[model samples]
Target: MKSLDRKFTLWALAWPIFMELFLQTLLGTVDTLSVSQISDGAVAVVGLSNHLFSAMMTLFMVVASGAGILIAQRIGSQREEDARSLAMLSLKVCGVIGLVLSVFLYTQPGLIAQWLNVPEALIPLAESYIAIAGAGMVFTALSAVLGTALRSTGNTKAPMVVGVVINIVHVALNYAFIFGAFGFPEWGLAGVAVSTLVSKLLGTAILYFIFIEAFHRRIGWKELARYWDRSLLKEVLHIGWPLGINMSAWVLTQLVIYVFLATLGVKELAAKTYMNTLESFCFTLGYAVALALQIQVAHLFGAGRTRDAYKATYKALWIGLAVVTVNALLLFSLGRQLLGIFTDDAQVIAIGISLLGLNLILQPGKMLNMALTNALNAVGDTRYTMVISFVCMWLVATGGSYVLGLHWGWGIVGVYICMIADEYIRGILCLYRWRGQKYLRQAEAEPALGVGLSAREQELVQA
Candidate 1:
């Protein structure tokens, strides 16, 4: 009865999701800031390794993302049992996927660094950092899956609370290990990686405790024992594979752009690293809104409130665009001060400032894509979004970055210009698809579960 417990409006849902994502992004920024003290080369190598890990992180989402959607719809349809089963199933699947990716990262760190074409001088540090940090992928995967389950229930606050703890501990560990503070050895990059691994492990454990305590309370471990569900797993994969691939394509495209920057030199890569950290603040606004919107829309769709679901995404999209416009402007105005916090190098500061300026135009387009693609996914329209992402990311972003930045010698500036084009191109296509409203036609495929006392309870607890 307590399984599908919470109701959410956009703001109620989004702010906590924003805080959680902000904390996660801050963790990455904190790592870069700490390593910036060592050398620009250190920042560059660590960034490369992080990109590789991130690309693999998308693979974990293949299961978590799909399962989250399934759980949300099932709960909306009043299928409490199915919703709980999907949550357990996601944890098992993500754990296995995470373990496999972890081993790959640990064993092939050097090879991946080479594939990224990182400078020879940076490869050794990158390899070591990757192995240590990558070994913890399982913890992150578990944390993510647990968070996905909670979010589907509209309980964003739990994950946000856990994130706050993870960030604090990670910062303290980084200081002790990176600088010999608290009598810890100054392990530098290795210390940073270890701190990350420890924090993620703690996050996973806490999230698991919360999951069992909150959702599986009556049954507890007995509920956890209800794991395998191949037919359900297939349904999740049916919805998720395109999404996972789409997510990977986006991250890989960003990494490819970084690779182009790496070809220019470590300075360029370091500059972009700072740029990315700063840019994360802008994207988080839209991403948080989009995620919250997806949960709300899925519930609405499952309840057969088709018109309300359609209106929700559009309403949220405009609001997201306005907020990000302000965020991007504020970030650009304080660009020098922010870049200064990361490094003392004037060139890096100058280059980072330039990217921040371009982001004024870039942020809106990115918001558009996040808002629409997520809304589309909420209605089970995954394949169309995936195809557009594949086309726009590679042909427009990747190829253009190479031709403009490398071949044309226009440098990071040209690469960024092309990047802006990629975002808008995808944004426009997403707009067109959402307008078509084919999702309405597909709604009958996933009808609601039979109504009961629990469904009446949910109706009484309105958003």
Candidate 2:
């Protein structure tokens, strides 16, 4: 097998991740734009159901994240064969879970939609979208596993290239299907769902082939099934469960708070929807950096470079914070124009303007939290992150939204305030953990994931 051109620099890794995430954000923007053409009600419906579908994706993340972290460690330890086995297990597991979730979402979108307190008029549109887009979860599952595998090995570019293709196909398909151009039937929002399904399937297939070629590995379904290793599964789960639960809690909380905004009325919900789409533009940049930090820190930790790994987290955090601040400001300056691109409602646009200004503070705080959490996750310090996230997401973000936004009559701005507070509080605690060097202690104990170095030796290596 060929050696990977493993340049573990932050920028090298993060740029591709940023481009990939940016393309994904663009796809969401395009989807929202297409749906907006139908009606603001359609936009609200698509946003509501899609958030639910995206929430269910946490299941896929648990397996993929566990395997990806372990794979990075194994690669750092020069155990390629073990990493390959873990990759196969992740693929198999995520595929099975995705199919199960897909069926549930498709079969009972209406039930969940109602439970979410979706407006009665929008319930039918939400059901159609949830059923169609929900079915594509299988493709999304496989792609997550494949993408994580490549990234764990320092090959972020392959997935970014594939994203380019996927987004192009989705945009073209959206035009054809939504407008009945190119001799296709106009199925409105349902057509948008179909386009998403086709694009996801295409991207997943391409990524699978690329993973095989890049890693010089061959896979067969029957062979993978026949050689299922319970022990490997256990190892992955041990490392990943906390991280998964943390993520799941956060997303579910977002869903809950969205319901709070929904109760504020259609205009408030529409503003929230439009604000979310625009916010992703800034969020993706920060998130991409945090993700790259995890990958880099994982390899350093695995290779016994403890001091380097520790420093890498803070270094990436500073850079991420500075870059995201500028990005947030740029987006805020264009907030009204961007809001106008989605709708002509003066009320929704006015509400969105305030939200964008709030996001300037929100994005920086979010970047801080994500960078620290991913750094800890890379070094297997997930339990603390999981605990802090569970507590803060529910109490600070979700619970506070109801109390302040509802009880105190602060409205949507109050929800944003609660969210910002959550981000900063969680981030500060993570920073405190990093300073205490508990992650270092954990690393020294678990030599395989940690850089088997003593405090004294780490200082020398870092020097």
Candidate 3:
């Protein structure tokens, strides 16, 4: 591919993934906004459920990230058949994992809520929301894997279209069920959960039709049962497990931080929830660009163009920083208005607005960390990435938050300060890792010919 041509490829790959993240964030925003109409307790319940959900979703990311790397490499090497097989195997494995997770969470949601130290008044709402969402774990897994597969093949538009459609459906359903509008029941928080599950299941079905049947890339149940490729499965697990564990650990740290904050009381808990909602919108730009970089850099690395990979990484990093900076400014300018959208409570809005200004400090460090980590993982340097993540989240974010925020009685803002410090520390570390020569060495450790693509298939990757 020409140098200029690769730039187009980067945008083509990144934009749809970016839209997907944006839509997902929009869906969350809509969910929170709609639920806030019920009560602040309703918003808090959804917020707590989302924190738990993030940890649960990490399992799917484990598979999706691993499968994406393998698919990108196979496509790069011109191994179409192996790429297809890996995609099929990933669906089966993720399905089983999702089933296990759904069962576990559904059966013991109250127990899970208890562990989170969720407020007694909100525990029932939280448990109800989680149980319903957990039941749809299989659909969530399928949507994530199929979307990643499409992205791996340079077919970003299909996933973006599907995500937008599903998000629209999600928002409409949320409005109807939350308010009993349009002949729907006023199910409140339960309605939100039902809408989420239904939307995800529909998304999975749509993706299956588009990617599998329409594209003639479908891998059926028979294939999954009869053609279990042990070696391919091992390759995916080797690459995917660390990444999954890394994500799971990272989310668990956030949950622990939430738990620490719970010790401060409901007002503090409610403030944290509103701030996170606002932060989600602010961080969407970085998250979207980071995702795009992961796919773009994966293609470059798989094509054995290390120089091009580095260039793409730097370009993406700069772009992410610019995007995040703008978002921070927007938040600073409109912080109170955004907070008011979530709650009419004057005190919650006041605390949330104060927290929003501090987000300007937090967002840039997080943007850098997110972009570099995704870039590194795209090149298969996941083990080191995982180790670094484990250390920072455990030592600085979680441990330090406990000491400074809770132990010192700094309250919600104190916890936010600790979070900012953690992001900067990890951001600098990831930047240093990308700059060093060691990343290439880690990439070299993976097998070059494991997937066995053909020349034309490889050219498709470079193109």
Candidate 4:
């Protein structure tokens, strides 16, 4: 049977993706845990550097996201060759973009440290970490695109396997480098950076081969070298540009919020850092399910099964809500213990527990937003979602965070109120959008997939 003909439940698709994201989240958590052994300054350095690293990743997000959406739809429609071509195009685009941005990070690390308002004592550590870790962006982009390609084709297991390997390598190397174990010299935060970069590069290499062997079978080297489908590339960028912009906008606003948090002092910064690591458990689960929904929805659309697409969206939403709610409750109950895993500081743990209390209310809205936004984007309604995200993220989340947290002296708790507001406000809009079926109408109204498979795709739709 064709891959597309294979039936899938929400869990069948989501669990592997969830495990992959869960391991990915664990990778960051491990980094934080390892770095915490050194000093609060080291933890702060890693945290600040990661903020910049995430923002710089906008380049990969656009291409990977766009390619994933397109490939899913193509594969859903049974245009395997077209899907393969798109997978290659996305890698080619993100590879060059990633390398160029990597160069920027290597050269201008201090600028980012300053931009984040890194405390004076931690500036050197933050700058060095970013420079070293940023070198891995190219590898990271390649691996991410490969993973996205695999997931789009309903091969989520491959990426999950790759993630497991990546995290294992990262953890082992982190232990050796951070503590100078096994005769390795202790390099502190620098060691953490080197371990992370090397592990990511390894993961990228593994995923690259998996992607080619799985998707590029029997295509000659000459054929591969000669094929550069400009139109497909253009279509990918057309779909990806808004997503890239949306991500960049969100990152910039987050950077601004970090600056506001910085004004509150180092302890608050550390508290926020620890809080984020804990919250990742909830958000990442929601994200994993939402991504699965996007793929499933795209497949349904590709098959011209519009009603099933709607059915799948609501089904995925409820699944995500259930998971996020349970996650929130668990985190709330174990807040102190979880926060203590990162630091022994009572004050930081106290701040984090209070913040998790806020997540009780925030997680549900966030889960909804994650599901609906990706559902919208998968159906090619990216522009509307981007616009709404931009407005709500800035006006409500960013601005309100500053006013409530800093000005009101409510600190992290107040900032969280703004965050909950942002999630629900935009989430409601996304739900309404999906319920109204605006994204479906827009996707159907668009021109057909035009990547040389137009005729065949049209036939598939007609049949």
Candidate 5:
């Protein structure tokens, strides 16, 4: 492969990730809009159920994240063969976890609904939706790891294509099943779940094929057995365990916030859901840049170029902030018009507009937090992020939301303030760590891949 300049490579990778995220976000928005047409209560049910789905995705992160870091580092170190092995390992691990969680969540749908404090009227709707959507958890898990693996190898476009396919399939199926169009049965919430599951399953299959090609057909039985090395598992877990814990903690914090919001009323719940979906449109840009930064930072760190890693992070942060700022401005300007697509409720649109205005204030801090945290994690500063996140999220954000939103009767506005506070706090800390040399110590703890690539890989590199 030819070596590309850092700046060119960064955007080359970031754009596809951005589009993939946008399409995925759009997918959820369509689901919300379709269900919104049925009833606001149904919209609330789908929204809350999807939040639970996000929390459940923590399991996929555990394996996908660990494997992703290692894969990037291995590619950086020019250990292509080992990277292939790690990709295969990540897929197997995520697939198994997905299967188990799918069964667990699907069978205990009511449990999940109850856990979220779904209203009595909405409980059945949420349960029925989650029960069917829960099976897609497996596809989600596998697709996440597969996409990450491909991205680690700098094949981000493949995942973007797969996402396009998912969007197309999901929208078509949703239209047909949602209203019984073209002779299809009207399944309502269940129909929405079917669209999600079928699209994810198909997308997962596509990603699997792409992973096989990207990794040089490395998923065969003999190759899988060969790649399942105990040491690789240990290395992956070393990096992924902290990330998974951190992600789970964050998910729990969000769920707690949702619990607080749910107490307000279903209208608040629906508003929060719309806010989240729309917020994704802006945050996706920041997250895309951050994710690209992670791969670049990991590659630099793997090559022992710590200073370049820092430079890459700062550069990515600037780009992320700019993109996010533009997105925020667009969202702020058109918040009402855009939100009105999901529902005709003037009140919901008003609340959502206010939330988007708050998001403009939230964007810069969020951009920094997203970029720097991912850069920190890429270089093995995972534990610091995990610990600080746990502390700030629960102590500051979670606790503040309850005191401000519920206790003070400030409602969703109070929760947004808490969220903004946490983002800035974490963002400042991450910035401090990036600017200083304290995080360098963690680099010494990274996995060693010896001096150079194998002769076969070396020959391929020379060729």
Candidate 6:
């Protein structure tokens, strides 16, 4: 494809996902706002509960993204059967992982909440929310894996549509359940959790039907039982395990930050909660574009078009920077107005606004790190990315947040300053990794093949 054509293709791939993410963000904001009507404590409970959910979702992403890389490469190399088999294996692995996580998280939520130093008053609500949400892990895993499969095959629109519908359902249900509207029993925070679970379950069912009947990509129980390709499984684990660890570390760091914020007292925790919601809105564009580049770059690399992949990455980086810059500026300009939508408390709004100002500097660096890290993973460079992520988040973000924010009495703003420092550090490292062309070597060395393929074909396969 020509440069202009490639840019357009990337945008086409990104925009729908962008809208989907925007809707998802809106859904979150609605959920928070609806719960906020109950009390500030309710919002805090939701935020704390969501930290646990984020960790589980990250684990799911590790497997789904790893499978996506292989699927994209296989499709690029015209290896349809291999791609299908990989998809089946991905489903089975995710299902098993999801089940284990569900049981563990459901049973141990109070321990986890206490570990995070969640407020005593909010702990019960947080625990209840997490336990209910954890029950939907199977649906979450299936939806994520299948969505990634579709994106890998260059069918981004289907996933986007499904995501939109899912969020709509979530928002409607959240409204009904949170307020006892439409004859639904009021469950408050727990109601939000139930709504999310039901939505995900419905989404998984819808996607499964779409994948099997509409797209004709069926993976029966027999295929899942009989297709135990050890080598392929190894390839996925080699790439995915590090990614999982990296994500786990990342989530743990956030939980640690939550612990730190809880010590700062309830107002600070509430401010962080509102800021996180606003930041998600601003960052969605970068996230959407980065996801698009990840799939496109992986496909190009798998097709042996290295130069095209590099060009695509550069294009995506510039686009991500531009998108984030604009959003950051808008958030800064309208900071108070946005916060007002969620809470009437002037103190909370003021604190959230201050957090938004700091986010202006933080968001750009974060966008850089997010784009480069994801693109690198697409080319199977998870090890390096994971190492950098763990070190920066632990040493700079977690450690610095504690020292600057808590130790020195700087409060939540100081914690945010440390977060910005961490983002810049990792962002610079990711840029260097990409510029040094280390990922190119990694991609060339890791050859993917079905155990049944011939040695020569395996070696010569573009992926």
TM-score of structure candidate 4? 0.94
Highest-lDDT candidate = 2
lDDT on C-alpha atoms for all candidate structures: 0.86, 0.87, 0.80, 0.83, 0.84, 0.81
Which predicted model would earn the best TM-score?
A: 2
- Candidate 3 residue runs with Cα over 4 Å from true position: 1-8, 213-221, 441-463
Candidate 4 has an lDDT of: 0.83
- What are the per-model C-alpha RMSD values against the true structure? 4.8, 4.5, 3.9, 3.1, 4.2, 3.1
Ranking of models by lDDT = 2, 1, 5, 4, 6, 3
lDDT of 2 by residue, 1-463 (tens): 1232356678889999999999999999999999889899888888777778768899889999988988887777666777888888898999999999888888988898888898998888888888899999999999999999999988999999999999999999999999999999999999999999999999999998888765546766666777687878887898889979998998899899889989998889889989888888887878999999998888877776777888888889999899889989999888889899999989988999988879999999999999999998888889999999999999999999999999999999999999999999999999998888786777676664235222334456667
Model 5, residue 280: displacement in angstroms?
1.2
Tens-place lDDT per residue, model 4, 250-315, is 888877787787888777888888888888988787888998888888777776666788888888
Model 2 scores a TM of 0.94
**Candidate scoring better on lDDT of 2 and 3:** 2
Q: Tell me the tens digit of each residue's lDDT in model 5 across 127-206.
A: 88989998889998989998998998888899999989999999999999989998999998889999889999999888
* Pairs in steric clash, model 4: none
Query: 290 in model 6: Cα distance from truth in Å?
Result: 0.6
Q: Stretches of candidate 5 above 4 Å error?
A: 1-8, 225-227, 439-463
Window of ten residues with lowest summed lDDT in model 2: 448-457
Task: Tell me the lDDT of candidate 3.
Answer: 0.80
